[model samples]
Target: MNKVTTIDLGSNSFRVLIYDCLNHKIINEYNEVVGMADGLNETGNISLEAQERVVDAIMRSSKSLEYDPKSAVCVTTAAMRLASNSNDVLKYFEKTTGARFKIIDGKEEARLTLLAVKYALKRERIDSSKFILLDIGGGSTEIILNEGDNFNSKSFNFGIVTLTQKYLTSNKLIEELDNWKKEINLFLDELDINLEDFTFVATAGTPTTIAAIKLGQDFFHYDKDEVNGTIVNLKDLDESLEMFKNSNNETITKLVGRGRVEFIEVGIYIYKAIFEVLEKNESIVLDDGLREGVAIDYCLNKSI
Candidate 1:
């Protein structure tokens, strides 16, 4: 039995997972908020502080991993792609830990996310004529369009963390949510998507956390079985947002936890806008994403 470890160096967080490929099970997983894209919008470069934090997180997670780095698949996404000092940071990481990281571009990111979601869809027995997958990360958002078995995608630079920080000081950010919906509508139009005919499948932290909150799953104990394939209604989501608006950061943290609570306000707006533009009243949440997709690909494509 081959044990495969995959690490997702996400913009908002760093995650490491060990999977039993033959058995199709995750043996161990660890996720930590490294905020690789923290203040990136303002700086146009990855800050020294953020880089240090990310390096520490990676080192700690690597220490806990059971598999070899030479064989493990390490993926770096949005934040690394956009950062001016990405090469230096990556080289430092590789030299320090002996783990080589591959920077997956936007289109590839979208494809992998859809691949993982499709796997989840099969696992859950959800049937649909066509389906679309969207992942809202810290530094970018990827939308995958699926017509039958064929897939294509569009990637946007805006994401929960970056979007929030971009408009943090705007007085009309809250009231201008509808305007953002129009922008997304225009973007979707450019992609020539047939939104009316396809089911919406959402991935990433925001949707999953929302599903968890709605199902009353606390931060200490989250069940993927309950979250994956979970349905999210826009009306209910609005209610949750309103509740968050009325509460303090401590309260919000208690609900969705640290790294996400800070971005939930913006993330909710993005979700609301997309669903409204697509005329989707609800979306099915999927817990699996790029990490799973990469791990599966490595296992299947490697030499037997």
Candidate 2:
């Protein structure tokens, strides 16, 4: 059977996936949160520590997975795109890990992500004719509208990590909520599309984490099959937010994961704002994202 590997060097995490192309199944998967964008907003560049973390993650994951770096479809997103020293960082990563990475633009990122979401919907026997896909990442959020062959997408600069660094760390989370909502609303207004006409589907960590929580799964017991295709209601998200607010850091970490405790609240807040502005009460959550998309796209191009 033909096999392929994919690496998603995300702003908040690094994920590696091994796929059996012929069987259309995943062989193995690994993920680690390295906070690649931790101090990017303040410096406009990737910190040396973050760069070291990424290189270490890449080497370790590749070594343990026994995958060849040369053939892997490795992609980096918003953090790299916005980093002024991305070229230098990429060179350092290549020299240290022997993995070539591509910095995909927002449009390409949306396209690849949509590819994964469509495949997941098909596997779940759901119609994908019309839907609005929301991907809330660490450095940016992508809003994609798909109507048959027509597609429109936009990427917003604010996300969980950046927002947390800007507001939560500064003790302005509560005070800045309204301003954040207004900013998101302004972007939605620019879309000029009737959001109510499309089904709302969300991918990435935030929705999947919410789905996991709703399914009574914790970090140690997460089941992607149960999390994927799960319908998460706005009320459920609000309740989760309240619980997180009242709970301590350790408790939140047990549910979401180690590196997510600090950003979960900000992520949930962003999701709530999006749902409120779009009048979306519920969303279909999926675990499949850019990593899956990269593998699928690679297989397709190779005619595997």
Candidate 3:
């Protein structure tokens, strides 16, 4: 079996996952939550600081992937796609490190996420209609209406860091979040989406963080088998929201994962809002997503 690595350079983090492509299984995964999106607001772009750090992280990983740097496909989403200076970032990374990173648009990101969900359900032999896939990214959230192996999708501007900086202005962030929730609900209501027909497949850092809290774990350790059909109470998420509001950023960084500390509460708001919109008090976390989707795409397409 051939080994191939996939790099998903997301707004909140940069992740590299190596897989036994033929066998369709993960071998090893490395990630760093650089909060690369931190200064996106100030510069109207992915910060030069982030670009330099990203280059260093990728170069570090490149040493380990020395066998075939060409086999590793690095791609960026949301933040890069939305940033004004994204082209410069891409060009610089490619020029300095010889790593060509593609900035995927919303539609392609949606397609990859859809592919991820499908691959997961097929591998596990679970019903495809079982859940609605939600990927809460740093710059955006990708929503896929999964129904019996076919899905309809949408990419929204709702993101944890963006929301935190934009709306988490007061203790009344929850109420303000309600307005955002209303938009989600209105969109779904317009579509007449069937809530009972679907379970929630929450992905990305935000959902994972909420899941970690629910399990009372302090780190990012979770088993897909343990979580597959499990559900998390919306009220538990609501409790977390209150917990975050009470704590300071420094405390949050100390307690929760590092990169997400400052915006964890904001993420909670988005997650809780989705729970409310779905009208289900609970959600299931899928630790597998995007990167897996990209790997599966490479495998099936023989991208290597």
Per-residue lDDT, model 2, residue 24, is 74
Clashing pairs in 2: none
lDDT of 2 by residue, 1-304 (tens): 6989999999998999998888778999999999999999799999999999998888888889998887788999999999999999999988877888999999989988998899899999888999999999999989888889778888888789988988744357655656766776777688777877899999999999999999999988999999989999999998998999899888899999999989998998888877876788999999999999888888888621
Best by lDDT: 2
Count of steric clashes across candidates, in order: 0, 0, 1
RMSD of each: 2.3, 2.1, 2.6
True-structure RMSD for candidate 2: 2.1
**lDDT at residue 1 of model 2 (Cα atoms):** 69
Compose the digit string of candidate 3's lDDT tens values, residues 40-137.
76677877778888888887777765534455787888888778988888888888877778888877887887787777766667677657778888
TM-score of each predicted structure versus truth: 0.92, 0.94, 0.89
lDDT of 1 by residue, 1-304 (tens): 7868888888898888887879777788888888889989888787888878877877787677655666678998999999888898888878867778889899888777776777788889996448877798998888777877787787877788887887764355655556656666676788786677889999988898889888988666788889998999897688888988899888788877777778887888878877876788999998898888877777777621
TM-score of 2: 0.94
- When summed lDDT is taken over every stretch of 10 residues in candidate 2, the lowest stretch is 168-177
Model with the higher TM-score, candidate 1 or 3: 1
- Which sections of candidate 3 miss by over 4 Å? 64-69, 122-125, 171-176, 220-229, 245-251
Model 1 misplacement above 4 A: 169-187, 190-193
Q: Judged by lDDT relative to the true structure, which candidate is superior, 1 or 2?
A: 2
